[model samples]
Structures are given as structure tokens and as C-alpha cells.
Target: MPVTKATDADFRQLLDQHEKVVVKYYADWCGNCRLFSPKFKRLSEAEPEVAFLDVNAESSPEARKLANVTNLPYFAVFRNGELLETLAASKEEAVVELISKLHAN
Candidate 1:
């Protein structure tokens, strides 16, 4: 699965369709976001059933607002279109935990 470029129009659709949706808020110029992109992609590939969406923080204001994102790279996990957990503090291990919990549910 490819990283989804999330916009205001498509964001809700992706959330509605997938059992688990992991949305990553990033910026094109942010170094942290750049470093995290590959990891996110690899995670998405490993879990093909999960929908991974990306919202460019610098460009997509609607998406950013919808997700209530403030950091350079923010992660939000939704199950059945309802937000299950949000992790914006930990580095990589946090994301792994989020994925694990999703699989468990």
C-alpha cells in the first residue's frame, strides 16, 4: 500500500472505509517528517489492511485542523472511524505500539 496523500475531501472517506486508519501529519520541509516517512511506508506495507494517510502540514490546513495536529509529525489512529489513540510524543516505538494495539483489537 502506498502512502495516502490526505486532503479534506478524501480524509473522511479513508477513515470510513478502513477498519484501522493511521493518519500522519507531516510537512515537506520538516526533517523529522522526512526521516519518519520511510518508516511509515514500511509499516503500511507490513499492514496492508490498515489505511495510512498523510496530510502535508504546510499545505493542507483543513486536514491539519480536522486531525487537530500541532507538531511537525503527528500520528492518530482510528478504529471504525472513531479515534482510538493519538501519539505525538514518542519516537518510533510508540507507533509500533499503536499498530500492535490496532491488530489486537
Candidate 2:
């Protein structure tokens, strides 16, 4: 599945709609966030069953609060609209581990 760009307006709805969701919280000026974008997209394509979302942490206050996003390139996994875990990292391995948690359930 392709990563969907989400905002404060549609974040909640997307969460509610997908059973397994992985959100990548990023900021426009965060270089790491920009660098990890392609990896995130590739991960999304690999896991077709999961819903991947990209949200600007600086703009999406409501979504950012759900995961308590404190760093750039933060990743949060949600199952059935409930937050499971969050990781702040730029490494693809770390993001893969976070996404693995979704399948573990």
C-alpha cells in the first residue's frame, strides 16, 4: 500500500478505518525525516496489509499528541485505532521492528 499523507482533519478517521496502521510523524525542516521518506514508502509497499500514514508533526497537533511525538521521524503503530508503540529513529531496521509489532498481534 502507498503511504497516505494525513492531517489533523483526517488522521482520526484513517486510524478508525484501518485495523493495522503505522504513522510516520515528520517535520518539513527535519533532514532525517526527509531522508527516511523513501524507506518508509518501501516499507509500506512491502506490507500491503498495513495502513501507512505520513503526518507533519509540526502541523498535526491532534495526531502528534496521540503518539506523544517528541522527535523527528517518529513512528507510531496502532491496532484498531489504539496506539501500541512508538519509536523515534531514522534507521530502517528500527522502523521495521516497530512495524513487526503490528503483525505480532
Candidate 3:
């Protein structure tokens, strides 16, 4: 499945109602964001149980600010709406690894 877009309204419901989530903060003009998009989607397809949200940093200013994402392609994992991990890497493998680790917690 394609990555799901999360708006401010849908964000809370998805988080509060789910067990695991991978929230990706990205901007349209960001090269890294472009590169990471498919990889993130692939991961989402690989792990269907984990909810993946793609938020445009430009569009979701509040989410960007709340998540403290100063850079594009930021990654954060949440377990039942609680932050479990934050990753700084842009590589798909690193993201997958981080999610794997966080899921273990």
C-alpha cells in the first residue's frame, strides 16, 4: 500500500488508536525526503501491522514543531501514541533497524 498522509486531525486518532506507528516528517522540496519515500513505503508494505504516516513538514507546521523536526526526513516511532524512538538517518536500512529495535521494547 502507498504511504498514508496524516493531517492534524487524523494524527491523534491514528496514534491513540494504534499499537505501533512510524511517523515520517518530510518536505516536498527535500531531496532526502524524496529518496526516502519509497523505502518507507516498502517498509510499510513489508510490515503491514505497523502504521506509517507521511507528513509534509511544510503542510504540517504544528506537527513539525511538536515533533521537534528541524530537518527533513525525520523519523519517529510511537507505541500507543508514546514516543519510542527517534532516528537521524536517511537510509532505509537504518530506519528499519530502528523500528525493529523500538518494536522490541
Candidate 4:
């Protein structure tokens, strides 16, 4: 699925609608965030069934707080609206593998 920009207002409802969700937290000015975004998008395109959301940490304070994100390029996965894992790295392969394993179980 395409990545959707999100804020705190609709975050819960969005997650409720998807069986599998991946939310990415990043800041526009962060160099690392800039570097990781393309990889994040590629992963989203590869997994069309999963709901992908992005929260701009520098602009969306509410979203950052809701996701409890502390740093740039944070990633969280949810299954059936339940939080499964929150990862700090920007490794696309590892994230994709983890998602595959999680969905399989």
C-alpha cells in the first residue's frame, strides 16, 4: 500500500481498520530520516496489503507522542490494532523479514 501521512487525530481509527499496519516516524530536517524514506517507501510498495503510515516527528507532536517515538526513523508494527514491535533501526531488510515472520504467526 502507499504510505499515508498521519496525525494523532486519526491514528487509532486508522490502525483499527487494518489487520497489519506499519507506522514510520521521521522528521523532515533529519538527515537520517531523509536517507531512510526511500527504503521505507519501497517496502510499502512491496507489501501492498499492509497499511503504511508516516508521521513527521518535527511537525506532528501529537503523533510522535502517541507512538512514543524518541528518535528519527522509528518504526512500529501493529497487528489487529495491537502493538507488536517498535524498532529503531533503518534496516529495510530486517524490518521486512520481521514483518513476514510476524504475519506468518
In terms of TM-score, which candidate is strongest? 2
18-82, model 4: which lDDT tens digit per residue?
99998888877778778888888888898889998988877777767666787678888889987
Supply the global lDDT for candidate 1.
0.82
Instruction: State TM-scores per candidate.
Output: 0.87, 0.98, 0.90, 0.86
Q: Give the per-residue lDDT of model 2 (tens digit) for 1-105.
A: 999999999999999999999999999999999999999999999999999999999989999999999888899999999999999999999999999999994
Q: How displaced is residue 9 in candidate 4, in Å? A: 1.6
Best of the candidates, lDDT: 2
Give the RMSD in angstroms, all C-alphas superposed, for model 2.
0.5
**Segments in model 3 whose C-alpha atoms lie over 4 Å from true places:** none
Residue pairs clashing in model 4 are 1-48
Residue 39 of model 3 has an lDDT of 89
Residue 30, candidate 3: C-alpha displacement in angstroms: 0.4
Tell me the tens digit of each residue's lDDT in model 3 across 73-99.
899888978887787679888888878
Per-residue CA lDDT of model 1 for 20-92, tens digit only, reads 8888888778888889988999989988889899888777787677668878788888899888777774388
> Model 4 reaches what TM-score against the true structure?
0.86
Better of 1 and 4 by lDDT: 1
Give candidate 2's error at residue 37 in angstroms. Answer: 0.4
Which parts of model 1 have CA positions greater than 4 angstroms off? Answer: none
